[model samples]
Target chain A: MKKNFKLVIEYDGTNYAGWQRQNNAITVQKILEEVLEKLTGRNINVIGCSRTDSGVHARGFICNFVTETTIPPSKIKYAINNLLPNDIVILDSSEVPINFHSRYNCIKKTYTYTILNREEPAAINRNYVYHFKRPLDIDLMKKGSEFLIGTHEFDSFRKIGSSVKTTTRTIYSIDIEKQEYYIKFNITGNGFLYNMVRIIVGTLLDVGVGKMTPESVKEILLAKDRSKAGMSLPAQGLCLEKIYY
Target chain B: MKKNFKLVIEYDGTNYAGWQRQNNAITVQKILEEVLEKLTGRNINVIGCSRTDSGVHARGFICNFVTETTIPPSKIKYAINNLLPNDIVILDSSEVPINFHSRYNCIKKTYTYTILNREEPAAINRNYVYHFKRPLDIDLMKKGSEFLIGTHEFDSFRKIGSSVKTTTRTIYSIDIEKQEYYIKFNITGNGFLYNMVRIIVGTLLDVGVGKMTPESVKEILLAKDRSKAGMSLPAQGLCLEKIYY
Candidate 1:
């Protein structure tokens, strides 16, 4: 009998091409599929909840796969974790409904972008954060983020190359937190378009640095022009924090 | 005229041969000296507060050097940092008294050892923490730590090959903090013998795991035998947090 398994994964995506499999580069999916094939003695197809960009990290990434192996669900995490590289870990594994889809069944997703708002860049966490030399105005950034709180057409916040049936999405919340020299933006939404979160963070950062006004965010959303939005932030600063079912 | 400068540095020591300069292996001091030489046309010698083990990290490591360069002390950090690798950063630099020394004038040092006490190891911070599979008893570790506070001979904690003038050191405090799956031991002392902090953490971990009782710490200290103490933990889990002058 075949069983479906859900895996809670955590990875340092610095060395991966992205979450998806690619021909020319290594990816988290390819590595995982190879390990799964080795463990179960069968070809595997793993479905990831988010297609995280290159150099993007994940704290609670969700994925699912069906397998004919007799290995217990609880033991799969330990077994695969031993085979996976140190940069990727299976935090938990469990038996799930056979038809449950990792991407389609997800209700909401949360992402956090960290900025090292200091003069000197950090050495230890260099790969985990973006370094911004200017002093950020947290109040202005918070006020600017208010305009992007509700459901809207986020056409201006997505990469130009991405194509979707609808560019409209619901943003649940955007929380800007400053701890010492680090600024973290916690964003949750029903869905995100390609590079949507990074562009939104960059737009808010422009407001924080007084390059753009808080009121301009609403105009940018209404304009529906990608060029009107701020530049896309680097991928390393962004992390897939959680996915709610 | 030669000017004495003090620099507060931070480094990810994964790729180096420790803080000290060596002939064959790459070291943090060697890198800094090379950068300094490029900026100023003189060979530089940097004195560090601690000879941190290979693969040990630092947050606020203090060091000093004398240079005859015309670059302002405040700008030296920026100048050298631009030439240094991303894994090492100069947090701050300033002119200091001519006779000041980083190792000799240090009053106290604070180090933190982080343990990821969970079933699986972490992927994002794999280089920054030590993963322990078994559940640790925090109260037992705390009880064992109390005996190590105050002045005592730490001969049993040092590595066997280390040649120290005296093994007696004053431990001001040892605070154990647990947040979720991470257990951090913050230790402040006037000085530390070679591998002393790692050995001490190993002893406390043994007590926490019930392999040794809390009372055994006193006996271990009294015995002053290297074999009586627990094994030395890995260097990656240890970090030099701060140095006081």
Candidate 2:
């Protein structure tokens, strides 16, 4: 029985190399595949909703895998989660259509970046959150986020080694919200280039620190060059919020 | 310059032997005291709100120490918290009256025991929570909590090797609150006999599983023998909530 299963997963990502497999490093896909193989004497490759970068967290990124084992979808989560490490959790697992690919058939994806916008270093969550001591203008950050919405040629924000050729991407929304010690940037888009979210965060941080104006974001997007954007922020602050396929 | 200082500290407790000083094992008090000796060159002793058992946690358990050094009270927290490990966070520190004590001067103490009420083993908080497979009836557990109120001689609940001569204590209240995957036993008391909270949790488990009734708690309390009480719960689920001095 070729069973197509969909899975919703959450992970810390600090210990993992990335979603993709590597020869020398531990990866999320490799861990899951090894766990499944241990369960049913056969190797099954799990496909992720997104190839999340190193140190990027996730709340509910989707995945799909085909297996010939007779195990039901309901028990798959329990079986896999039991074997997985403490940092990763499988939220929900179900049988879906055979044609429903986690990556290609996706409708939209949402990501969130968190900054511990305070003076003191993050003691407990230092690995998960980025700590910024500099005072950030919240209103200016909001304005910068406003300029990020809709279709734009985000060539300036794309990473140098991005495999994709197209730089034009449609962002559904960009929400900048802040609490006492935390600032969150929620971004929804159809697709993203390699290290796109991190570069955008770096630019927003530049805008927040008064180095650049909110209106300057438009010019940076239009420039369509990597040098036109700010440096790429670390991946620890970024979280894959969800995947809608 | 003999300064009497108070501290409200929080720790994961997974890495510590307990709050007391031991010869070889790692302890929170030992860590703080060693750091104090290194910085000030005087072998200073650190006192804690309680001798929290190994693997137990704390949120705001008070501790006090005296030093002759001229390190200002406002700066002590900065110096100590900086030296402490990542799992420990000094929330506040201030100069206190020389007459004040962390343990004896407290009005009351509050402790909470959390049971991860789920089928799957806890992944993220495996060290911080206790997992249970059996379902518990919340209303029945609430009924059992009523028996723990007021003054009682809880000899059965105390550990057999406890040095304390008196077994009589006053339990202010017992609150059983359930939310999703957690069932918390929030207990406040004038003072607790050795391992009283752990035994109480074990007895409550009996109540939740239908082996014992809520009214049976009195009979066990009056038994005044260690064998009459339920088994002692694991230390990992217990947390010293606060020392209400």
Candidate 3:
């Protein structure tokens, strides 16, 4: 029987090349494919909601896969997780409709970026967080978020190879909080371009450091020039918080 | 200058064979000794407060080394950390008298054991926590802490190769707290025999699981026989919190 399965995955993406499959490097897709093929003796295609960059980590990222195998959806999670590396695990799995694509039918996606701001360097979470020695202005960063809201041409925020045809997307909300040594940036959006969230974070950081004005983000958006934006933030700080479908 | 220097170190301990220097396997002491030999031109002897077992991690385990290199105490921490692996870090360093020993001068040591109590296994913290299938009674675990406190000869909770002449130790405190998916055991003592703290935690888990009464721990301590105590818990759940001198 043809079936669609939705899976909630958690991964420490430091060891992997990225979420996508590649020839010379380790990837989450290749790991999942190997487990599925080994279990069912058939080639299985796993589609992930986001192609998170190398060094990025995820606590709850959604993905869907289709197969003609008669194995129960409940059994699939256990069977696959048993073979996965210690860095990746399936948190939840269940049957879904045939057309339920984790990427296409999504209503909103939330992403979080954690920064360790302190004098001493971060040791334990070095692979999962970006350590910035300088302090960031939260109020100024909040002002920058307002410019990113609503549908507009986000060419400054999108990477060069982002396959999406249009750069217009709605950011539902942006919440920033600093707890202890961690500064968390949680943003919700209807859709995001490749490296969009990370790029936004980088530009906002520039604003926080007094390098760029909060209003300059609007100019960058209107100018549709990538050169006007801040450099791409390190991928280790980013995480796919949740995907709504 | 046969100078004595103290080190407060943190290590993941998964890839390490143990804290002691061995022939083929990688160990924390081996790494530290190599770094010291290169930084200071002497074949230095290093001593750790606890010779932690394989896969047993530490947050602030203490160690001391003697060298004739004449490097300042302030520079030792930064210099050694530069050569250490990502899993290992020197939190701080200080100059101490030649008579000071990390083990002999220690007043108290604390350890924490984390249990991820849930049906699903963990991915993010696979190396840092033990996964359990059932929910634990937090109150029962807290009540069980009382039975393990105070001065006691814990022979039943010790390992076979313990070199200590006596099994007597004073437990300063036992704290149990339940977080979202983790039950944490925090224990402080003047000194612990080999595998003593892990065995005590395992016994308390049995009480939490309804296999033994909470008060039974007192009897096990008084028994003074190795066969009467609970099994040693896994190394991953344990973390050496601090060693006070």
Off by over 4 Å in 2: A77-82, A89-92, A108-242, B135-140, B173-180, B183-185, B205-231
Candidate 3 clashing pairs, residues 3+ apart or interchain: none
Count backbone clashes in candidate 3: 0
Per-residue accuracy of model 2 over A1-245 as CA lDDT, tens digit each:
69899998878788898788889989988998899899888988888888998888887779999887788898889888888998788888899988888998988999998898865555445666787879999899788877778988888888897778688888998888897678998999998888888889889899999999998888888788889888888988989988887
Quote each prediction's TM-score: 0.96, 0.80, 0.89
The true-versus-predicted C-alpha distance at residue B42 of model 2, in Å, is 1.4
Where is model 2 chain B poorest over a 10-residue stretch in terms of lDDT? B119-128
| DockQ per candidate, 2 decimals | 0.85, 0.27, 0.47
Give per-residue lDDT, candidate 1, residue A214: 96
TM-score of chain B of 2: 0.97
Per-prediction fnat = 0.86, 0.23, 0.49
lDDT of each: 0.94, 0.85, 0.86
Fnat computed for model 2 = 0.23
Query: Which structure is stronger by DockQ: 1 or 2?
Result: 1
Tell me the tens digit of each residue's lDDT in model 1 across A99-171: 9999999999999999999999989889999999998999999999999999999999999989899999999
Model 3 TM-score, 2 decimals? 0.89
TM-score of chain A of each: 0.99, 0.97, 0.95
Identify the leading candidate in terms of TM-score.
Answer: 1
Over the full model, what C-alpha lDDT does candidate 1 score relative to the true structure? 0.94
